[model samples]
Target: MTEQKRYAILPLIAIGLVGGLLSGLFGIGGGVIIVPALVLLLVMPQRLAAGTSVAAILPAAVVGAISYAVQGNVDWTAGILLAVGIVIGSQVGALLLSKLPVGFLQWLFLGFLLVVIVSLWFVVPQRDSEISITVLTGAMLAVTGFLTGILSGLIGVGGGIIVVPVLMFFFGANDLVAKGTSLVMMIPGSLSGTLANWRRKNVDLRAAAAVGLAASAASPLGTIIAGTLAPSMSNILFSIFLVLIFTQMLVRLIRAKKN
Candidate 1:
């Protein structure tokens, strides 16, 4: 490997170690962690970081989904619907990255994350609840996935930030089911977005591989931990995580403003 590539390896692994645990535990693609780490630590441009994060997310999403599936936490039918919508929507989101300004996307991302954090505090998580999908509910699920896919592509999140909350708050799914299904839906969306980003020359393959592999390796452990946590506890932990990230981003924005 080149000297520059070698230097990037350790950072990628460190970021992935934390991201993978979050991905498996929360059913997110861990892009929230990966993107910022890339942008703030590696000094990468926002769009490129977003694209690389999506690419790195795919493997972790797949592993996390499998871990949940094995425990029968996944709602396959709902997840499939979400996946179909996200696959198409992710392409559109990827297109937008090239068109929109980076500062706009960054502000938009932080705004959205703040909303998610607030919602998590108010929404009670169900551990044994399940989704009852009718035709209308199915349609809504698809729509949710479509919107989340756009966010994932644009913000480099795995779409779980919205999907998990929506499933729990709107669809009456338990936290485990929601998280598992979120991971399942992310697989296609992440794959589709990564390809689109790659075609646009936005992906950094070496970094993605380094992060993706490490995240995948660590996700199973997180899956096991998720199984042990109560739904209420999980929500609280996730909320705390979001709060820290929100603070980090806020500080970054202030620094940028000052500069």
Candidate 2:
């Protein structure tokens, strides 16, 4: 491998390792971590970064969902219903993305990330066990999925931040089940959004593949590690990751304002 390719390997592995653990622990798809890392480490353009992140998320989420499923943590009925809404919402969001300026979209994504970080830090509910999903619960799930899908398409986050919180707070899902369900919902939405971006030549297939393969390979180990961590420790790590990302966004936004 050339110098650039060699340099990319470590980051790819790091992203995969960290992203998978986060996904397994938090019910997040790792897009928040992946997108910012790609931008900071690889100097990838925003559009390609988003697209590649989405692409990598597909496999990572799959691995995460499967792991959670084996632990009897998946709620297939709710997951599939939510996914239906997510697919439609993602398509609409992609259409909107095509009309927006790239800079505006970047700012929007940064703003969204800030909101998620703050919410996860300050407002997320505390609970240890899984909650049951009813018909009423399914309706709420659909709405959350719809909004998450829209954001996923716009920001390439695969909707994990939104999905996890909703499942935890509103739907009353346990952390493990919520994470698994989020991964399940993310599959179709990410795939759809990625295809939309791919049509616009925004996806870097080679880079995505490199990162995704590593992520898939490492996800089972990450999931096992996640299962070992205390919930409080997992929350702390997740909070720190969010704070770091939020700080990065703040710096970029300030720099942009100055420019």
Candidate 3:
């Protein structure tokens, strides 16, 4: 491999390992972590980072969904319906992103990341049982999916952060079920966003594939580990991860302000 390729591979593998663990534990797409890290560490351009992040998210979500499915945690109907909305919304969001300025996009993404970190830190808690999906709840789910799709298209995230909280808070889904459903919902949105980026020639397929494959291979292991943890232990670990992510974002924001 060329020096540049060799340089990229190590970071990609590191991203895959951390991303898979986060996906298994938090029901997030790992793009929130992966994209920023790529930009900072790999010197990847923003659009390329977004596209590559989406591409990598595909395998990670698939592996996570499968693991959750095995535990009988997936809600197929909800996932499919949410995915449909996500795909449509993502198309519109992608078009809008192309028109926006780079600075604007950066600030917007930072703001969104802040919101996610705050929500994860403050809102999510361990639930005792699954929530019943009522008519009102279904409508809310559709709305959340639409919003998440737009965000995903704009930022290259898989919308899992948004999906998980909504599932937990509004739908009363258990953590495992929320994680499974979020992964299932991500498939179509990620595909649509990735295709849009591909058309623009922004995707780095080699990097994406490498990271995706590694993340997929590691995800089941993370899920198995998650299953082994006690409820309190899992909660504690997840909280620590959230705190770490929040601190990273804060440092980024502070640096941006300084510069």
How many pairs of residues collide in model 3? 0
Which one wins on TM-score?
A: 1
- Give the better candidate number (1 or 3) by lDDT: 1
Candidate 2 lDDT, 157-183, residue by residue in tens: 878777776676567676567777888
**How well does each candidate superpose onto the true structure, as a TM-score?**
0.93, 0.84, 0.85
lDDT of 3 at 36: 85
At residue 34, candidate 2 shows an lDDT of 81
Every candidate's CA RMSD: 2.4, 3.9, 3.4
RMSD (Cα, Å) of candidate 3? 3.4
**Who is ahead in lDDT, 1 or 2?**
1
Q: Determine which window of 10 residues in candidate 3 has minimal summed lDDT.
A: 1-10
Candidate 1 vs candidate 2: the TM-score winner is 1
Native-to-model Cα distance after best TM-score fit, residue 209 in candidate 1, in Å: 0.8
Model 1 scores a TM of 0.93
Tens-digit per-residue lDDT, 54-100, candidate 1: 99998999999999999999999999999988998899999998887
